[model samples]
Target: MTIRISRRRLLTTAAATSIGVLAMPYLSRAADRPQITHGVQSGDVGADGGVVWARADRPSHMMVEVATTESFSHAKVLPPIAALPESDFTAKMLLENLPAGQETFYRVRFRDLAHPAISSEPAIGRFRTAPADRRDVSFVWGGDVAGQGWGINPDDGGMVTFATMRRHRPDFLLHSGDTIYADGVIAAEVKLADGKVWKNVTIPEKAKVAETLDEFRAAHKYNFLDDNVRAFNAEVPIFVQWDDHEVTNNWSASKQLPAAYKERSIGLLAARSARAFHEMYPMRESLAEPGRIYRTLHYGPHLDVFMLDERSYRGANGENQQTAYGPESYFLGPDQLAWLKRGLLNSRATWKVIASDMPLSIIVYDDAANRSGSEAFAQGDGPPRGRELEIADILRFIKSAGIVNTVWLTADVHYAAAHYYNPDKAQFQDFEPFWEFVAGPLHAGTFGPNQLDNTFGPEVKFIKAPGQGQQNLPPSAGMQFFGHVRIEGATGQMTVTLRDRADVALWSTTLDPRPGKPG
Candidate 1:
């Protein structure tokens, strides 16, 4: 693979080559070398490029080498990026001008700045670039990891669902939010309903809810402690977004902090958590809005994924029955909603997948005990109201623009289900017919098959969740689920399959593309 190195990178490489002779002796001394704390990862891959991430134990310059072959004999050495204390010793670089429709292997090593002669052992990673043509596309997506006290259980095989998803060998993973349960506390041991004990491999930062920046950063690091997670990260590129749990449970601008949190200001916690989230993952930095999570990921001509940021722009969790489109009804907020509409109208892919962190039409109650206020984009089974208005506007826009073959994929409900939005049977029926498939709880407690709020007429096609008396079931209950998608290059048909922890295909359906020109 030919890489066009920047002038800065070329200079850095030349300097490294010169230092190699003097560094040879120190390299043999393992004790003096810097340490790679976590495994390497790659993400936000496109036709030509992607981002690669790694962390070091101390202040160091992260050196990267890219090659098409695993042997890496003719690897192109990129510029060394610093892994400093400011970013918690983590560093990531965007690798560009790579060949499309090919496997790219990368190796990451940390050269200690303190001891310029010494370097850490390399961590290897790989990712397949998006094809420029209509090649077959496959990806797995799910969310809510290490949540509700269900953390890495050594006895239970340590986040084995990741291992299950890894076996599929998808092109990438669209992590549908709740990447970390920052609001959920992890206990070492807890008695189960079956008269057994569920044990977690815990750390100090995970013992309580994440508040400080270090604590939030540690929450992301805690997931890497699992063998399955680290092994999965090494191979699969992840496109991640955040949700409520990444900050606090159902958090909004007006969130009321619980007694457990000594920090009374929710704003401060959100700020710290946002920084940690960006630093921990391999997400491509947005130039327009640096901290923005809503963006479009075009994966060849087959699929274009629009990942949304519902939490960051939302107003507050309250009675979501507002009739007017105001602050109380703001879900995706004005800017993100406008962006989604524009993106959908401009997308030329056969399938436009809206990768939402939260499921629409699902009645997620912020006050579950009373079932009063809404948490998601639904406000019971009525005409478009509250947050549903924003979604309704998008749907109406899609129909008016004649955009075809749009599908919604989401998690956040802690269950797996397929819903077909039939406009004909709806109270509000301006939108076109579409499908929303939900799958999740990668390694968290199993909850519901939530009640559907038919604002736009969502018909339940298939659902798999805990029974009436089985809410918050343990991961060992075999209900942990995820979703897989594969689009055929020849037919442009999209097949979505929901699977369990054991990699069993619980349910699946294939949708053929509508005969229409791409918008």
Candidate 2:
């Protein structure tokens, strides 16, 4: 756990590191109430305890407290918790008795009566728990950071690759969907018929649903009052999974898009944007009852984290038969696909990961891959739009549930891709090594019109290309690139780095857990 490489001020030779600890927190201004201009967050950590948050300013409930030290006098403090201006004050604090990979320290206080009076000059984080599900575990993923339209600079794309993955501190975080562009807007109303809007794609204005529920809590306070997305919800602890603009465009709860998937008000505005996106992200449900974030996260015996809801038990496509690749159309339907094939046939966990948000390999896009003019594509030779048999029924339930060590980490293609894609022959979906990695939208940058040269025209391609289909990317991980991974289930081995916003590392690769049955 000692990686101190150099080279990186935002370019050239390329190398970076940061994880020394206990020295970089400083916040003065006489003590208290700044309602943070975007800062304070922690999430899903537990070898024992982890999860403290902050968003401050609740019409006067805000108490919340915690400590390890940064001058709470002798901080060990706990037990304040309030913050509820009906949730706009956002706090959370699910702390709980700490001690498991121990590196303890925290900060986030706000009270005038419960007694911390005011604090928040701390933000040094790191956590590691899950140590035995079976023997192998690694976490890190990507998603559409759709915000701040036009060609770039959405908080320096993926928070500069998530502040360079909070300096290589991975244990959890996988959002394979547009985490919220709730109808973004910046490229000036996205016009076309010669109206101009088409340079970088910002399209905002479509979160329509929730005619009541206070306009769905003002669209979840418009991306939790973005301040580099509240400092990436205060540095990691995410598992969120929802695509389709989190509420509009291409929504499918009985349809809406292009011509007519029919029925409107998009299933009560996608159930009020999944209940305001689980009241702002602590996300972890899916057992049923108009809820269930598609559940499954082990991480100890070495890895499991399934996390699916491919748009809530999918089946709604109507606009001229949308088709997510036939077979009675249903993504993770069939009772969570028989509970993900009996939880990967009684798993022991040595790696399973499928926090997918669509794209189990078979991307066509480019206006459905140049139709009318005829190359006659968009998945015809029997697989493309058929979605190669919904990704060969997830690789035939991992070769009839022998459940080796399947791997995948997806995000709605906003740019930043990697693929090995396999279907045996005749482009069953394009052949070989069905591996896919896509990191994105750190703050949302890089889209269309020759996106910084990763050009996807005349045929659409990506495979970390530069020769084989050609992709040469890395003008700072468009959408501000963000993805980092490290795992050592003793021998499962893993590494993926992709960074930006000064903490650079564009692309990386390493994976070895094949598990078997591919012949």
Top-scoring candidate (TM-score): 1
TM-score of each: 0.96, 0.31
Error of 1 at 119 (Å): 1.0
For candidate 1, write residues 411-508 as lDDT tens digits.
99899999999998888899899999999899998999778877898899899999898999889998999999999998999999999999999999
Worst 10 residues of 2 by lDDT: 1-10
The candidate that achieves the highest lDDT relative to the unseen native structure: 1
lDDT of 1: 0.88
Give the per-residue Cα lDDT of candidate 1 at 292: 83
lDDT at position 286, candidate 2: 31
Model 1 regions lying over 4 Å from their true place: 1-23, 27-29
lDDT score of residue 219 within candidate 2: 48
Tell me how many clashing residue pairs each candidate has.
0, 28
